[model samples]
Target: MTTPLLGCDFSSAPTRRKPIVLALGTADRGRVRLERLEKLESLAAFAAWLAEPRPWVGGFDFPFGLPRELVEHLGWPTQWRECMRHYAGLTRPQIRETFAAYCDARPPGGKFAHRRFDKLAGSSPSMKWVNPPVAYMLHAGVPLLLEAGVHLPGLHAGDPARVALEAYPGLLARECIAQRSYKADDKARQTPERLIARKDILHALEQGSTRLGLRLKLTHAQHEALVHDASGDSLDAVLCLMQAAWAAQHGAPSYGLPADLDPLEGWIVSA
Candidate 1:
């Protein structure tokens, strides 16, 4: 059976307002075909999905680690497992308090805690809002991935049939739009211009405009559905779709990934 390529738009606290949405697709001869798969309403439902047997490679849009600097400064364990253990032990309020204290000491523009990976990868600071709102994502997403027991390639070693990679749609979107704002959940900013820009970006990806040399093919209705969703949920899922395409194309080893992710440092798809 051909392995499926998966892309997930994750939420730390999945609810009616912020459900976990996954995009499922496959690649053929360097082209990707994407469609929405399932919208999970609760973490329990999402956990069940992860446990089901499947052979797939996925690009999930969530921070997998923190900046190494933040990890070290907080005196937290550096190894992925250990850091997660420490984090998991703390209550949400405790975590917020700890991180808040760190933020208090740092000046604005450096408030949110950061990891070394943030600097090295040129990724968004885990605390930034405007660019990706990843800080909230990190707080909300990583713990669940760990709990789900999904094998995170390059960070943790486990099942090969299910491979997880830290993915950023922005990494791929910027390739096509280059700093153009294509989405704003705030209705006030969801102008026709932004809507048109999103459509154009989708078209460019469909036509294989990126360095990955992969075109995303979608039905006219699929295209419209993605555009109509004002929350950027569909767009984020598509961005993940591209990342999954890239990972599958690169031939990431089946299961059994490396097990040395820095908790404060995030991971990236191997080049």
Candidate 2:
């Protein structure tokens, strides 16, 4: 019996315009055969998926916590689980007001507090609300994972068979195409060029040419489906799926993290 790998592209508020995307598959030796991709309509739906009986290892694209500096400055709990509990309790307005106050006190360049993994992986600051709104992603997503009894490897212990790791698809995508714009949420912006880049990315994965050393096997229909979604949600989910595959292949003896991982700020796998 092979273990399943799941990758998720999350949204704080999912609608028909943009929904939470999931990529599901299993690793066969060196190849990851993509079985299906699904778009969940609501947080309730996403939560139901998490609570399902099938044991899965998933790479979820969301910040697991705020930066250590930010947490310390605000006098929030230093413990990871404790911090999340505190965070999940606060209302959205309370959160925005608190973060806004913190940013206002700092200088322009150094205003945003960043996790160590943000520096290493070049991810958006977990506190940023405007650009990617990953702050909301964490608020919306992580608490559900906690409620579902999913184990977050180094951060939280739960059902060992139901593992969840923080993943940033951009980390893998950038390796294949150095910051080249490959996706846009707007229908008008989905150009031929971005489609070609997606093709290149798909090809690279199929050829077993990534640092993770795993290839992607997809049926003709699946290949078309991955490319047809110009929004890149599907592709992002697959990138995360591959990252989960790497962690599965490696297991979590190290929890697929650096030895010096901060308990206050969880590390992003393959960052």
Candidate 3:
């Protein structure tokens, strides 16, 4: 039997208003089926779900590692596990103060340190604390993954059956729609244009038009559910699902990650 697959659109601080979304599915050949979508409204609930003893591979939309340059400059632990343990101990304010100070000391053009993978994936630096607040996301999320003891391909050794890979939904979304805005958190900003973009992305996924060569199979209701969420959380989860499918189809162990990936800075799968 093929291992079940999951793709998560995570939130560092989850609540009923904006919960973490998981697109649960299974991939066969080059086609991926959307079995269901799950929303966890609390980090505690998310942790409980992660601890469930099951065999599956997941693509999670969170930075699995920080920029090595930033870590070294901060004098944090060099080893992946040790670094994460240290990071997990800091308060969000502490993180903001430290990262902000580092940015303030740097030149304008180079305010934030970046991982090599960030450039390749066009993702915000893991050290960025605001706008997207990915820094807080990393601060809140990675520790939970580690606590769950899921295997992080090149980074940590854990339960091989329960594998987790760092995923960025933007990487796959950009492939379909370029830079067109797709979804918005603010109701006023969730314009028709963004809705149309969501449709376009779904259509492209259904048709397998992107570079991954894998099609997404969704039911009629599933199709509507994904397009209607103006926040794009569900759609983003599905995008991560497509990425997970590609990685699974490409073969295991590395799951399409580069062989030379930085051990201290985990890579985005399919980047």
Error of 1 at 58 (Å): 0.9
What does the lDDT read for residue 225 in candidate 2? 86
Find the candidate with the highest lDDT and give its number. Answer: 3
Candidate 1 wrong stretches, greater than 4 Å = 107-109, 117-122, 127-136, 254-264
Name model 2 segments beyond 4 Å from true: none
Report the alpha-carbon TM-score of model 2 versus the true structure: 0.97
Pick by TM-score: which candidate is best? 3
lDDT of 1 by residue, 1-271 (tens): 4578888888767888778889899889877888555788987887788877787888888777776677788898988778767766776666667667888999988687655455544577665433555655666666666766777766676677788888777777777787787887699998887888788888888989887788998988888988887777778877887777787776655332224544346466532
Cα RMSD (Å) per model? 3.1, 1.0, 0.7
lDDT of each: 0.74, 0.90, 0.93
Clashes of each: 10, 1, 0
Question: In model 2, what are the clashing residue pairs, if there are any?
Answer: 252-255
Name the lDDT of candidate 3. Answer: 0.93
- lDDT-superior candidate, 2 or 3: 3
Which tens-of-lDDT digit does each residue in 160-202 have in candidate 2?
A: 9899999998888888877787899988899999998898888
Q: Which candidate would rank higher by TM-score, 2 or 3? A: 3
